[model samples]
Target: MKKNSESKAGTSRRDFIKAGTAAAAGFMVVPRHVLGGAGFVAPSDKLVIAGIGVGGKGESDLKSFHDSGKAEIAYLCDVDDRRAAGSVQRFPKAKYYKDFREMLDKEHKHIDAVSVSGPDHNHAIHALPAMQLGKHVYVQKPLTHDVYEARVLTEAAKKYKVVTQMGNQGASGDGVRIMREWFDAGLIGDVHTIYTWTDRPVWPQGIQWPAQKAEVPKELDWDLWLGTAPYKDYVDKLVPFNWRGWWDYGTGALGDMGCHIMEAPFSILGLQYVKDVQASVGTVYVDEFKRGYFPESCPPSSYAVLTFPKTDKTPGDVKIHWMDGGIQPERPEELGPNEVFGDGGNGILFVGTKGKMMAGCYAENPRLLPTSLTEQHKLPVKYERVPGGASGHYAQWVEACIAGHGKKEVSSPFSIAGPLTEALLMANLAIRGSDLRIDNRYPGRNLKLIWDNQNMKVVNFDEVNQFVKREYRQGWELPTV
Candidate 1:
């Protein structure tokens, strides 16, 4: 069976002709059985999927969908051939292309859905058209590069009536459900304050762009990779992963892991568009006398505070603190001196009127403070468990697509992922606002920028609104929903 599957994996769409010829030679295959009628596909029929950005995390995403056994990898697209090599080898029969536009243009008929696992900047660029063409989309986390794009995609999902899921797999994990149960049971009363921190940037940041430019790799399409970001001379090591630290291509640490770290609280608390946001970021010194301020690059470390209006789950407004670049909140008194705080490196903490709770990245390993409370408390399960938990996220989206739009429930559909993404980007506005300088003076400092979620703009800070919706490059435009 493994050999048979391998052989099938290597067959391209062009092989259909050969398959037809073979079938005509008295070797017809069994027809799929439909329970209701002949028009309906049998349970065995798989959804044909096209993967955009089939490298790194994208490569793993394609594998997960294929492994679901309910989806067939029909096409793979990527700008970097070297990065996409593994996926191309694994899905031998899948057609390959460098530009996602070309792939979607030619293979739209053959693709049932599109899985987008690209850099933060190009997610919306790749996803918008696919959705317009009525293809279901599963975009990797941070859904879009900016707040406006997130809102557009969210509305587009509903307008197109396509099954949509953001690649924040933790949204479907048991850890969040367990935490939800605890919160609903009033173990941790109304959550008034929340803190999520990460030791990210693990990449270069708080530095100037390299003065020297390097030759583009032979196998990589540098122009195509830039997609919606402004074009610049090729820099060393920016192709595969280092792009995360740059403002043009990435969303810094908060956007990198915010979805994973803050997902549980957003869901359990029913949080939405933030009411207001403010921030302060650490600075790097280029020399003994001069401080480094690279607007193109994210700051080395920063702290942001977002205020969310009250929801039924909370008594009043919720103040959420986000720290990155190795910053963390203070440890709770309930925890032992040596006890781990949110898995020791990155985690989320919730402080309520009654007690405190914390969880590591992806809301995993959730526990109430005092350690003993986790094991001692018993709460009735009120949420449905996602099949296969976090790992099930891919299969869930695949099945949802197979079931058609609105037919099945998806764990991190655009509706939910969009607001979460928008809120994060809103927090980012504060970070970027605080960084703005006017003749060596930071004017955006110490101001609580009011937000008009409906208009998607910062009422108090007009300059920061530029980051709300970035202008796309000449060739790419965010599709009008």
Candidate 2:
């Protein structure tokens, strides 16, 4: 097992100093204080931000950015006006709009940044335009509705020269950073397999089918809510919150939670691409009496296996297994007595050659193995603490905007997130049908899938690739990458 801070593992303080100096030389500007809050400005001096989706997560985003004091609310846009009422009330000074484009066109100069907290499909639509306008963007997790869109947004951010951050805020946390430090220190030797699962029973699992059409609420915009997605009659069950389980709107359990649980291993291990992936889905269960928007029936619970080849940077193979619908992997005995596994719906379990490590969703406080080793582990004596929690994520992005800082070399840029999203999105594809095999490595193989990041298509499977990128209804197309 590797040593923790208590044990003084790997690099010494002097070595870290040399490394830090080298890193500093690569970047032209240096802050007045290396570890102090000198480079950032007060929230009052921060830029003006608009919210594209001001319901659900969007509401939370408003509070986070507002609390940062680094941004002023300039606009609130949501298709469902009723859902946005609270936000509209909170920011009376900020204009409210049912459509985002109207707000963007009229208040273009007044907005300095945008928070995209819409459904997975709508994220790219709102974010791309904002970035194209040189507005900094803070988009929610899973980045895009489809794999191709993720790539487009990443490229656009590069061309526009804007500061960008995905909603997977856990990626910026101290716990996540500590996880990286431990891995680099070789605490877990040659990690080859990982298990991630979520017991998301709240929303029904699988795309069994849609329930019967019901009266659309008087206050909701049914047509607008269905933006970009296929035209479907309004159903009471599908609206408000349960849209995630449906194929047309949400990405089911994996897409919904993958970014959160998959982040630790992806960041700490530098997992770049998936070599192959296959999934076995449960039977589709249907509810005869369609209440709200969703049909009562749903697909059976699912289990998927993702195989990742060794990359140039990480030369060891890794396997990621996902479990959902009240299922979990067999706990390893090595965790020892008095060890409590995470009780939450999502958790990550890492098994290295020497020891094991596990962290909860959102990269909260993690627990390491060999309880006795805890005392022996010596972490890097010197470290920098970035802000934490949801508020901190927004704070960092706002700070970057004011400082004119761009993407970090090792950070989770849109380029990285795009592909990461693609891999996760494939799991959703596999669960949709059976006997589908994906070989992302090359096109020569018969099962080859070639991705045109710009067009968002798989050349061979035009029909299937069409699903990779979505089509926008009139007036809703996200800007081209």
- Estimate, for each residue in 167-230, the C-alpha lDDT of model 1 and write its tens digit: 9999999999998899888888879999999999799888899889999999988888888889
Error of 1 at 442 (Å): 1.3
Q: What pairs collide in candidate 1? A: none
Candidate 2 yields a Cα-based lDDT of 0.67
Count the clashes in each prediction.
0, 27
lDDT of each: 0.84, 0.67
Best by lDDT: 1
Runs of candidate 1 exceeding 4 Å displacement: 1-44
Instruction: Report how far off residue 410 is in candidate 1 (Å).
Output: 1.4
Could you tell me which 10 consecutive residues in candidate 1 have the lowest summed lDDT?
1-10
